[model samples]
Target chain A: MLKEILYYTWGAVVSFVLAFSVGITYMGLNRKVTARVQNRIGPPWYQNFLDVIKLGSKKTAIHHGVMHHLGPAFLMVSSVMSLLIIPILNNGRFYPNLNFHGDLIFLLYIMTFGPLGMALGAGQTGNPNSAIGVTRGLAQMAGFEIPWVMALVALMIQYKTTSIVDLMNIQAETGRWLMFSSPFAFIAAIMAMFGMFRYSPFDIVGAPSELASGPMSENGGKYLFTMMSSGSVFAFAKLTLYTDLFLGGADNLLVLVLKTFVLYMIPVLYGVVNPRYRTEQAVRWFWGWPSFFGLLAILQASFF
Target chain B: MINDKESQKIVDIIQNFARKHSLWVLAYGTGCGAIEIPPTMTSRYDAERLGVRGAATPRQADVLLITGYLTTKTLKRVIRVYEQMQDPKYVIGFGSCTINGGMYFDSYNTIKALDRYLPVDVYINGCMPRPEAVLKGFAKLQELIQAGKADGSKKYKENLEWYRANQKEVIPVWRMPEFNW
Candidate 1:
């Protein structure tokens, strides 16, 4: 029993480390890609590592209250929790920590836990910008989550199961990725992803020009460092979740990285050329077409 | 076996190296010198290649870029912003206005010297420094950071009384929070 517990603990740590590094690298690559698109040579891919380290080494951090201190901690908790539950590889020796049946529904709820925790922290700061940003973030989350949940519900009804592992296993057995099998659900989820990633056209929550980075205006030093790492971890877990659900979960680490990177580019590339949307427009956007596709996915799942 | 002092030095080296590479400049567009920043940040002169990026707020910023001249009115806010910044912060006084008030030299309102009000690590000396000059100023700041010479925050803490005296002379009505570093 002790050895099993130790092994699970070790696996969780390794998975966290892997997810963080991959997520940070993807963010760095996003910067590089943005730079190249704009006819400029960007910073190196390892720039974020230097940034996180510098933030960690900073001498002072100010907090308004206990919630402010716990905001990033809350974000980290949600991120690690999601990483542990999301299976990293299909048949790997090291990954898929703490995953269980009916985890898909649990995953969806847990993913939003961090942001709400952060909102509580942001509210405690008494910064009006942080308040506005948190509202915008939550509103946008409400907007995107409809289609995102619809997509998941469609999959659940179609498969008659809530386990992500079961979904991957079904895909493996049929030798068909769900992206082709459930095209509307994929389309809806992809649209929702634009908001999920918080890119342009939906990036009002942290709109630097208008809101001074919105929810994160007061966070600095160690708080910012923790937030950054958690953001990366969360990003990786979300991407991995998408890959497992639609792209047929990876058989190995290299495949996992490749598939996740390809999945990651959808939002990053879309964010590059597009301009931002106001809060209402962003919320309305998700309600319009993505939600339409989501309905179609549900209809298709039930009848056909 | 390394001695404690040597081990400390090694850690400092690594810390300084990271600090030198990642500079999140607070976009405090104080004066006409702010015009030059857009060009410096955008495609023609991308500062990100040097790991210089704009930070949204003073709390998250490492470098405070004071663009253009400081009027007695704006100085209070500038001082507040500077204090809000965490430790190991830097100040880059941009343009000739920051150096000696430039065109505002004879103006009654503008402070002629920026150093009196705030500790400046680097000064880009031109009436309006071009993007090239701005990047050069950043490079110089990076060099200073690596050498452990850019200690403006330290200087501010050490001579808080004197700095407060200077700040009080211009502002007159000082109703600010007690700056506890």
Candidate 2:
């Protein structure tokens, strides 16, 4: 028992480190790509690393209360937990025993843990802008979750299994990735992923111009650092989950990285040139065609 | 194990390097000099290449860019913002207006010298410094950071009384909270 616990602990640590490094690097690439898109040379790829370190090194920190301090801790925990649950390599070669039998629903709930914790912390700050930002974020979450959950339900029903590992095995055996097999579900999930990525058109929560970063208006120094790091980890977790679900679970680290990076670019590239939507508009857009695609996906799953 | 002091020294060096590379500016454009910021940040000049990006709020910013002549009314808001910012923060007094109030030097409304109110780490000269000059000023600030000479926050803390007095004299009401270090 003790040996198993030690192995699990080691696995968790490795997963955390992997998620952080890969996620931060992806962010740096995103910035570089965005700069190139705008016809300007961007900062070095290590710019994000320097930013996080600089934020961590700030001379002062402010906390409204215990919850404010704990918010980032919760965000970190949720992302870390999600990373651990999502298998990174095929047949779970990387961390074999760590992938539990049934974590699909748990993964969905865990994904929201960061935002919910952040909302509570923002509430305690008593800043109206933070409150506004949190409201928009929660609303957007609700909007996206419908189509997202529908996509997941369609997959679960079609596969007749709750275990992600089982889902991967099914995909490998059938020799048809879910992306090709269930095109409607893929479209719906991809649409929801845009909001999950918090890119342009759907980025009402932390509208920098309108709300001064919204929920994070009061967070600075190490507080901001923690948020940024957790965000990267969460980004990796979400991307990995999508790759496992839609694309066949990657056979190697290189394939996994490429799949995840391509998946990440969908929302990011969309965000680069588009103007942002108001909170209501964002919610409406998610519910409109995306919801329709999700419904069609579910119907197709049930009928065929 | 390394001693605490040794660890702290190593940490300080790392922190300084990171801080120099990622300078998030709260460009609180209080005057016409605000117009120049777009040119500086856009594709033409690309301030972002130097890792100098605009921050939306004082909380997230490392450098406060006071872009031009500050009237008495605006000075109050500026002081409030400066206090809200977390430290080890730097202030850049941009444009000749910020140094000696430019054309507004004799005006009763505008405050002539910004450093009297806020500890400025760098000053860029010109009626309105072009994007090139603005970039040069940022380079100067980066040099100051590397040399360990830009300790404006520390200076502000040490001479809080004098700074506060100057602040209060200009604004008679003195309604702001004392931002204790």
Candidate 3:
């Protein structure tokens, strides 16, 4: 009984450390890359850590009763738990790694929980501001996700397996990244995915200027810290997942960093060019034609 | 004496330490003013040099800068978030919206002045201010931080009676879900 407790405790500690470090580091780099693209000297690489520390220690003011408090927690818990199922690699290489399939589709869907819970939590506060933020969030989720998910389906069709291991092996044998093998589907999914990341123009929901941090307005102290840390970790996790999926060719950490940063930059650049989408206009843009485009990409992958 | 208020003081001190250095904006894309926040803080304008950033959650924000007009529909959410923020929190009214309602000042649906409901410190003027102007606001905030002000906590400690009554009388946005005035 003691042994079992020790084992579980040890696993929890290590998982937290790994996820926390990797998550913070990647977001630091993301800040830097985003900084370069936007033409400014962004915060120190350790800024996310500093930010979380501040949040964790602050005075927690709970707003709108219970839902606001619960929402940030719900959003955070689901994201941190996802680490358990993910295969943490010792290095970026596919062969010598502790990789697991991590129920990839589950990871994607559950990740949505953090944002959705946040949206609902904000809504329940009876914050009309958050209600509007929720409306915009729902629309953006619809627009980009259709293409992103459809592309994932296309990739699944090609691989014949959903397992991460199988994905890597298939790539190694074929010597092709999905980006190279099926550029359109890959690009569509990535474009949509990055758009969903809310790096820039896609930041239609949670308009800080408008909604006052949207749903998170009422959350303070450790509750707020958890949300912030989870988000930072989530950002890094996203880059890691995308790196493994597309840029696995580089042999070393430095090379991997270069490729990953390049990929990370694509969306940050989008921040420079576009402005926030009006909620109605954003929904309309996705409704009729873009969904059709995603369908086309899936078809092209299958036929061509 | 770890009374609820005293324990809160220690926590408040640490939170302020964290708050002064790194500020983040929430994921909310509520108003057009959000568009300008990113570039000022990202690589393009790099708001980081001044230690200003757009965070994804309120837990991370020190200054809840309200940039645009708040409608009856949105004010409740804003007040709730303002409540969620840790004490010693600083609020910046970024444009006309939070001050006198800006363009929406006379609108039947919008709140007249944010201060009618919540407390505020700094104000950045513009419909949608330029990145430079936004950063200037950041710089002003930083200067206050350097002076050890870090946005006061008085509003939180002020006798509750005034605000409770004011919330009811002035900012009816506090009453229920949405009451079109």
In order, the TM-score of chain B in each prediction is: 0.97, 0.95, 0.76
Ranking by TM-score: 1, 2, 3
Model 2 alpha-carbon drift over 4 Å, by segment: B4-7
Per-residue lDDT over B107-135 for candidate 3, one digit per residue giving the tens place of the 0 to 100 score? 88787777767776667888888988887
Preferred candidate (lDDT higher): 1 or 3: 1
RMSD (CA, Å), candidate 1 to true, equals: 1.3
The candidate scoring highest on DockQ is 1
Candidate with the larger DockQ of 1 and 3:
1
Residue A246 of model 1, lDDT score: 99
- Top TM-score: which candidate number? 1
**Tens-place lDDT digits, model 3, residues A178-211:** 7787666666666675556676666777677666
Query: Candidate 3's C-alpha lDDT?
Result: 0.66
Clashing pairs in 1: none
Worst 10 residues of 2 chain B by lDDT: B172-181
Query: What lDDT, from 0 to 1, does candidate 1 have?
Result: 0.93
